[model samples]
Target: MTQAVAKEPAARPRRGPDRYVPFTEHMGVVRERAAAGEAVFSLELREELLNNHGRGHGGVVMTLLDCAMAHAALSRVNYEREVVTVDMHIAFMGPSTGKLVATGRVTGGGRSVCFCEASIVDASGDVAAQAMGTFRYRDAA
Candidate 1:
């Protein structure tokens, strides 16, 4: 005699603005809707994302900051316009564990360029990293 084994269903891919962006989707970033000039993003830390010290990788933290700041710059412009990072400076405050939450806001900008800042906080509510970025907006054809 044999008995059937139950299997768990596969997890569904997240859907939203993040899904539309290939890199964001690959990174499993969740985009939280926010008012103009602001954006929020979140990511779950996995073993693969850890550094040698068992903390979140610096590259991952930088990517999160870049994405968040870019999103913030985009928020202040027309949705059809594209924004590209011109310069970014990041400071890692401390190691991070568990889920990472990032928030970004546009500080200032002109018609063609914008300045933005972002901060990442760990699940424990400790700030893990912060960044300031300059982005240029490309007009749509």
Candidate 2:
């Protein structure tokens, strides 16, 4: 037997993912682009988002990565469903300065789960953080 696949959303003007996520909005995280099994998000380092050393706070980094990875998982299903991070492990490389970009890709998984990896690079193109995560799919409605 085979399972049915989800339908994709209607096409729209080229921009960020056509969705409004309150937390992402509150943190100023923008979904720059998304495709099947891939997604990229970005955020500007603000005073409140920075740690004492003038780098992005750990919470900020983690949230950005989680969002990006979970989106990647959702995209694999044509975004017909939502995904939640079941487990995630992140490594902070060094100070993240200027605008930061996080890119996520679906490594592997089955229908109900996805494995993803993401990395954050600063404006200077230095890697500031990397993460691996597991996400489980759920109904969008």
Residue 85 of model 2 has an lDDT of 85
Worst 10 residues of 2 by lDDT: 9-18
Q: Report the number of the highest-TM-score candidate.
A: 2
Model 2: per-residue Cα lDDT over 2-120, one tens digit each: 99999995664332357766677788999888889999999998998999998899999999999889888878888787777899999999889889999999999997899999999
The number of clashing residue pairs in each candidate reads 0, 0
Task: Provide the TM-score for each candidate, comma-separated.
Answer: 0.83, 0.85
Cα lDDT computed for each candidate against the true fold:
0.83, 0.88
Q: Write the per-residue lDDT of candidate 1 for residues 1-141, one digit (tens) a residue.
A: 999999985565332233266576677778775458898989998988889999999988888888788878777773556788999999999999999999999999898999999999999999999999999988754
Clashing residue pairs in candidate 1 (N, C-alpha, C atoms within 3 angstroms): none
